[model samples]
Target: MFAEEFVVVDATSPLWNAARPFLDIALRIEQQDDSYLWHGWNKASIDAFLQKLPPHCSLMLGVWQVDAAQEQETLWLGCICEVVDGAVCSLRTFVALEDSRLPAIAQLEPGYIHAQELIRVTKGQVAPVAWALFTDKTTWDEWLLAADADGQPTDKGEALAALARQGRCVLLGSQVTHHPHHH
Candidate 1:
């Protein structure tokens, strides 16, 4: 069975107010998938339910089953919402490694690579579909470069300005019309 969780970084909430909506979705999804599969659920569902969920709620769908390790580390399926310019997109993924480096199967999986490339190409944006996994202090800087490369920003200066104006902005998951300062 698959386990699911909904995480929201509401503009009005203090806990995750600094977080981007898409990032919250990604984390919640990862956590739910991790917890659910540990309890022995083979199948999971989210798409149909998510379709009807409020824009403020971010969903994560995960599936896994017990394996020879007897620790339930084997994950069979995972997916998260990718947001670009306020649009929601889906990315199918699987975990190849966890802990330490926290690297995932997407690194070696050709299908995931192809899907990411397709998203980059089709979206006309430079941001990676899986950027949240690489988040840290430099995330904003990296995102500025990627957005500039993707043509989302006209130049470094403009990107910097936008970042300054928006702080840490996220495009996917829930809908946030006004920036934190705006309210």
Candidate 2:
């Protein structure tokens, strides 16, 4: 899990091509509801965001099917990482592309909430989500239901995370047929 890991993005970086697929969806979604993503997703914001960004943060281009996505709706996200209050985090800025930019797709399913939380995370933790330039604004991070000694979620978001971690399920007491305790 620890070798050498870092994402480099700028005007010259190939990550610019990553935006093409999600362009239409984010555009329509943003227009239908201004609350989803502002500015959409494009090169200008990426350039400006990069120009004003610090060395400690990063811009993560990832395929995400989070809670906001409806049934199997996956969107490519241009996540801008920045520093605030002495800690590195996501800026929460949304960039709306003009009419020609976008990204691709994938799915994580809707009924299962575990995949939503665990997919983007590594070792049960992910970078604080940010997209906007930050001077003082803040957003909260999320946690799972059960935890292990290694600090990873043992059981949560349904049984997905827990079953994958321990590989076996142990039921106890008399209530629902399925419970979280597994070993």
Candidate 3:
């Protein structure tokens, strides 16, 4: 549910008690095609997720894959969620990674296309799709330079500023607003 559902697991949620069983179910579902199976967790996504989550609620599900066609190391993580009135999503993929890095500046379009395609490929088990994309550092720095180097920012610059996190490491926190038809 991480990439497909955007499930954010809050320890304070009423469903906290069900975490183990929930994770068990999530792990059993095979989201990827047989050939794209991941043998283990991606270390980078794990570190990133831990840094983002609070100390008390660090538990989550993480899996990794090497996309041979793209030569990318893709990782999907789900912390689970408080959604569905405790129904729709018990697990959610929060971050989608390739080569252990966020999508680069020029790669956004294709990145988005691939992500959106997953919903269809995975059978639309999620609600409206929402994504918070973090561009690689190069993209962030380039944005800083091109959008008025160290000066007053423009609208896009302002947006980057707002989405900036962890000392402004993130550039594009854009959310895909289009809601795919849930099957």
Candidate 4:
């Protein structure tokens, strides 16, 4: 048993969707009670799981049904997981969108630590809860610019730096640990 769990398809994973019914599961696009339902795949989660598999071993794939309320939707994100040695190894997700511009996340390349955090933050979470904020170029740039014009960090810079440290972005790079100016 691999004993792994589902990650919330971090902002970096290609599978993240911002719209309601974000997942592939069937539900109304518009809601009367201000809530809709959804079920979808999260490719990022699957990829993370596959890497952990033992070579040449059989992998059992099945759906993990999750039903819960998120934001304005009572959603069901149809999740999948691989069973290795009779234990769950990884939980991936699926999402289908009508628009061509898919949702974006910070984690284009999911590493072990990133994947683990997703599981910890999103495991057992559903729908909107599983979905993270969308960080586009402009938003990311502003977050990076919290530093002064000279590129030194301020108090806000430190907070932004903290977000970067939590894997929000990599722009901080070597500067993440740089000391912030203090009075």
Candidate 5:
């Protein structure tokens, strides 16, 4: 471990209260072989969850199953995440999309503990946005830090503009003209 590394600490720990503002959490679960992701919790949800924690209870990060069709019980993991918000942030391990080990919800066997703790991190120590935006660090960095003077992305805007120019970004419901005379 480096002098500073990101790891999961108990949510009830005073360390968590001290660092809560800078944390972001992503939740995943397996239900009857189906994998679902809650993505990241919104601020209100997180705040509420934090307020309800008991002294040493586990932080629910994901789920594990112990049985099949007949068993509807879901297990929650003891985990929490602290990420640095930005493109160029902390280093983390990534599993490629094509990697065989990447769990498929349908194929997962339930009834196990899948508690995963993020490495403990301090403010500015890791980029939380990178974890949410991209799997690989190189790509995440290139996109996040590639801002121009206007603070827009360097590599992504042109394509989106081209799409918008072609009228792809508009929704059908929003395409109606409010002024009937204006056809």
Candidate 6:
């Protein structure tokens, strides 16, 4: 599971401001899914799901079901988001129990749990941008460590541009399954 913390330093923070443009777009995408239900108490459900997940597994969002009748799944719903160049900041999606081989929702599903944690952390906020699903670690590190003349990163806009220049950063939206140590 990937856990990250993003705080709105200020109401006018560039990231905060940049995030606005993408909210409508993200919400429209979220609205496409009908199978996934939107609930208020997502945190508790996520905790329960994580307790039962296997390690190294990540969640996939925007996956279409074979049956067109089924509603598209909504992954990372209700999370705060910001747009960077027309992409949503977050990329993970919540898979429906029916679509996955994983156990029932009652059982702890690590992927579900991790997704929930992400939602809680972002408080339903997502970056107003879409990132490529497969990113290079070195490049990601560089983006994270990049700073401007005042020692500040080039802001989300610059980061997105930099990421594009280097290569597509793989967007990991699911939880990484923890492997049991073999003695």
Off by over 4 Å in 5: 1-40, 61-108, 112-183
Q: Which candidate is the best by lDDT?
A: 3
- The lDDT per prediction is 0.33, 0.30, 0.35, 0.32, 0.28, 0.33
Q: Rank the candidates by TM-score, best first.
A: 3, 6, 1, 2, 5, 4
lDDT of 6 by residue, 57-163 (tens): 32222111122366322121211323332222333222212234333323322243443444333333332122212233344345544545543213543464546
Cα RMSD for candidates in order: 17.5, 17.2, 17.0, 17.9, 18.7, 19.6
TM-scores, all models, native as reference: 0.22, 0.21, 0.25, 0.19, 0.20, 0.24
lDDT of 2 by residue, 1-183 (tens): 001222222433233354443334433542453233222333333334345534343233333334444533333343333343323333221232111222222332222232223222311233332321111011101121223455332233244334324532221111124445555
User: Which window of ten consecutive residues has the lowest lDDT sum in model 5?
Assistant: 114-123
Residue range 73-98, candidate 3, lDDT tens digits: 44422222323322234343333222
Residue lDDT tens for model 1, 46-164: 33333444432222223222245663333333334443333344332322112333344333222334333333332332223322121123434354234322322134323434554
TM-score of 3: 0.25
The candidate with the higher TM-score, 2 or 4, is 2
Model 4 regions lying over 4 Å from their true place: 1-121, 125-132, 157-183
Pick by TM-score: 1 or 5, better one: 1
- Steric clashes per prediction: 6, 28, 6, 16, 12, 42
Clashing pairs in 1: 1-41, 1-42, 1-43, 2-43, 96-105, 126-150
Model 5 has an lDDT value of: 0.28
CA shift at 61, candidate 4, in angstroms? 28
> Considering every candidate listed, which one attains the maximal TM-score?
3
> Clashing residue pairs, candidate 3?
1-92, 1-93, 2-92, 2-93, 3-93, 73-99
Worst 10 residues of 3 by lDDT: 54-63
Query: Which runs of model 2 end up more than 4 angstroms from their true locations?
Result: 1-54, 59-63, 66-71, 76-78, 84-86, 93-100, 104-146, 149-183
Deviation in angstroms for 129 in model 2?
13
